[model samples]
Target: MKQAIYYAQLTKKANEYLSCLYDIAQTLVSFDDYDDAKMYLVKISQYKITDHVIKEKAMQDLINVQRILTGLEDRYEKEDDLQKKMSLAEKCADTYSCLDRNERSKYYYLKQLKHAQELNLNEDQMATIYSSLGSIYQDLKEWQLSIDYFRREMSCRIGLGIQADIE
Candidate 1:
């Protein structure tokens, strides 16, 4: 039965398989079996997903499960070159932020900020990091910390002769 289902999925009737997946995910999520749902999405990501509802979700979950959460993070930890490390940190932070995982977002942003400071990157780069940190803090509801970071961003802008405005 499982082999037949697998063969059907790989053949010309792939869309039939694709359309059922989102329903399966919904049922799994309702049952709080989120891990299994995510795996199903990942498994079907190889196909051209025409199902609008599941396409975006499946791709995001695929990257989140396969790369950003695991591969990129592991690479970040093992990476030695400061520039490459900073790049990975920024990518991880941005991806996590987009995924609404703000805690992990904040962590990677701080990692990027630390590397930026250690390398004595230019004011513009520092300002961007400060701004990103500020936004993360705002999302996290750490008002005081957010204000401090915005202030740092302002200072960076002023030092760079750019008119600074804080929202």
Candidate 2:
């Protein structure tokens, strides 16, 4: 990895530099070093890689992840079981959240909330989802929406006999 970084810097040509960055990023992703992988991937994007294969591999697997999310959404829509729908929604939400696609995450979380309500899930289970939605709204600077969800979460916690210090 150090060698790859050194070669990436040492290379004068754009193609060589991009290839080295791709290699480093690919290796990082395989090791679950996503933070480092994201760094190298961003570096690759900064340079124009004429090679499409290198571009696809380095730029994501991210492209494929979106495909996977879409597939999950399609399956969720077609699914007859509420449990399965919740699971799919969770996968989509978590993936979108990790990608910093908060709007998409919000969508799935809403779906999950709907399913949980339909299933009569305990307040404890729903509370965390409310908290997540609250934080998401906060991140997007939707103050009233954030306060609404936080209030809902607070209600859930209270209903579950959990005491919290409210500010």
Candidate 3:
């Protein structure tokens, strides 16, 4: 009987912690404060009341949020270095893509592609951007746009005297 009561108490506490963690996650998104959210996630993940699964899930969410925040922060911080800025922008786009935020991914990818063009990056760099855009459009099921971007990528590779090898 004592063991059953103890288990019940533990379960109740775990449920409460899980609810609190979820509430915090929603609040973080609403507030758009990644730094604080990261800290909060870390703290929540450490709560002994929650089970391993909940803890792991919280950690994964922290990683995703951190990646997005870092990409956005780094992209703006390296304004003078167009290459670095583009790289960070690409990371941001990829992170959003992984999170299933295709609209944001497309927006950031297009923005970076424009920046790359304005800066007159090398063919290889431009080709890479075109490839990324092509893949993104393909994922979004915009078939015509995807084909056009892929063709642009092929043109870029051809200009650089390289053969496209199914990439």
Query: Best candidate, lDDT-wise?
Result: 1
lDDT of the candidates, in the order given: 0.76, 0.73, 0.73
Candidate 3 ranges with C-alpha deviation above 4 Å: 1-61, 69-78, 160-167
Pairs clashing in candidate 3? none
TM-score of each: 0.66, 0.58, 0.58
lDDT of 2: 0.73
Per-residue lDDT tens digits for candidate 3, residues 1-167, read: 23443554576777655656545664664566767667767877777767777677677767778886766656555577777777777877877675556777898899789788878887788889989899999999999899888887887788843234344
For 134-167, candidate 1 gives per-residue lDDT tens digits of 9999999999999988988988887842235445
Rank the models by lDDT, top first: 1, 2, 3
The model with the greater TM-score, 1 or 2, is: 1
Best by TM-score: 1
Model 2 spans with C-alpha error above 4 angstroms: 1-70, 160-167
Question: Per TM-score, what order, best first?
Answer: 1, 3, 2
